[model samples]
Target: MASPWRPIRVWSPLLGLGFVVALIAFALQLSSRRHLAQRLWTFEELALYNGTDERLPILLGILGSVFDVTKGKTHYGPGGGYHHFAGRDASRAFVSGNFTGDGLTDSLNGLSTMEVKSVVDWRKFYMERYIFTGHLVGRYYDSQGKPTKYLKGVESKAKRGAQLLEKQKIEEDKIPSCNSKWSQQEGGKVWCDSGYPRLVKRPGDIALTGKISQRCACFKEEELGRPGLEVYKNCDYLSQSCSV
Candidate 1:
């Protein structure tokens, strides 16, 4: 990566004049469109489609944060003059507009940054939700194997805080085991991660089934796609599955 300013000194005065002209034009355009009401579609239009009065507020709240606004209406930025309509925001700080190809919309999001498939980085998608929001993209599952429809990853809002997954970096460690007859009879068993027992990704020695732990905490009903700790069924499902 390199700056393109290597030969810009000769054009410095010209560039300065152009910049001034551009800034003034931008300012005037903004001032004129600040209060123009437009027909921007809210998140409700995207989410419920028809069913309203339920999650409409929540969805709109997110939409307003991701778009732009001028005066008091949704401003979709310059190209289209402005957005369709104002979305929603607590302090009216953000508004929904439009995005074509990439990047975030406004700026309100909460997702554990991770690579989803063999390709595609989820960082931009994660940011786009909270900043410049859009329709639900990801799906979160509880350890019980249930879909968390209300959210994809998790939001920082206190009421929705439980769904949030803490990004715990795993460290290697040896696990202890029991040598009981039943253990031996059942082909024995291996304890899961000795250090990160609650965050099991695969079948292992120890299964922390029904075990209450800070590390294994999942606020969302589902655990996204992390295997072993599904929330459905009775206790010890994980433990039994990992029986050695």
Candidate 2:
């Protein structure tokens, strides 16, 4: 005869485990909502947490996102090396390396697409290293904590920068860069071990930056005369090497 205890033994563990998982998931969701609720901080409020007062936690802002960097007190405190970056959104300075006076501003104006992407990358670095606290209500975000048009534009440029970088990597794999060297006695020389050296438009340079950029690359004989490829000046069309 089948015993009732057998059914309890089979189902009890599964039911208990399911209940525990549901409880943990609910707790995580609630915690996330609480954190997100802390969004929308004014610049003045952010400035108060610059690690001057022991009572307040050290905070830093980047790309509108604020993070609790209290654990890095040695690096962000009043006398720390990165103190200028604390309690302010100096997004541009991440790449500009100008951390004083006007350079500490959050303006991304006139920055190149790749520079803007570098600023975004710095934000990602902080996000992974510190606890996210809130959003700063200025240039990058509105008082209601929504992204501003300027912020959206920066993100779009950054995305384009990433695409450009990927395209460049693909192009490099297809046409590897040529080996090069320079000397006062020998001038400059570029060559390939197995293919001819040619100059080609840098991937995405003109479209993204409106500047025509080119680089020397090695290409197989059959790959010559591609749309962007041009023979080096003073070098034979099929020569594997060139001097500059």
Candidate 3:
């Protein structure tokens, strides 16, 4: 009769403590799930976040590398020009300029020089513009998701090609101008001695001097206006006889 509710009141502290512990446990579980989501995602899981649901982010893959393109949803989302590339590697497609499913692969075999260069350019573009997530485990990667030999080869080729391109540019800048000159009477013209080497014989090869096969005509100014155009405009220098 002192107080009918006294017993329940005395146990209130314990019940409150239990509730606090349960809440903390639930919070920890939620945090762990969030962390897992931010970690590496498999290709199948990536496809689930293709911006189609409006709840997940938009993502894309290139050469086995994944990127978060959510920031570019306007261009990568549904009905966007690049929507087809989302949630897939599609490295070959980028290089071959093929937007079909058949091009959605990482295989670099049989790609021409320009195509390979295109793939390299696309890789640089993604790296500079998007957030890198992880790699895909198909075509460009092995079962365990490690980079495959083919991928490595393609990368090596890209690097080598870039280096070669840079070198070629430098060499081109150093080429001695065929000392081209302009004359009103003859129009623009360039005269090469009996022995003069070509500026470029093959791709990336430095120009080497060669003996003249025959006395050639002076090149017209208009013909020499473009690089390597003079070679096709050879004529008898004495008479300046050649098709302009």
Which prediction has the highest TM-score against the true structure? Answer: 2
Candidate lDDT values, in order: 0.31, 0.85, 0.64
Which residues of candidate 2, in runs, are more than 4 Å off? 1-37, 179-191, 221-244
lDDT for model 3 comes to: 0.64
lDDT (10s digit) by residue, model 2, range 1-244: 8766643345588899999999987887566346434677888978888888765677889999999888899999989999998888888899899999999988989888888888999989988988888899988889788999999999999999999988878967876899999999999999999999999887577655667888988888888968878888889988889998
Top candidate on lDDT is 2
Angstrom error of the Cα, residue 160, model 1: value is 12
Overlapping backbone residue pairs in candidate 1 total 44
Q: Which candidate do you rate higher for TM-score, 2 or 3?
A: 2
Per-residue lDDT tens digits for candidate 1, residues 90-178, read 21122212333222232333221211110111223324542333332223223343435433322223223222222122221232222
Looking at candidate 1, the ten consecutive residues that score lowest on lDDT are: 112-121
Give the per-residue lDDT digits (tens) of candidate 3, residues 131-176.
7776777667776767788788887777766776678567655544
The runs of at least 3 residues in candidate 1 whose Cα sits more than 4 Å from the true structure, single-residue gaps closed, are 1-24, 32-149, 152-172, 175-201, 204-244
Residue 10 error, candidate 3, Å = 36
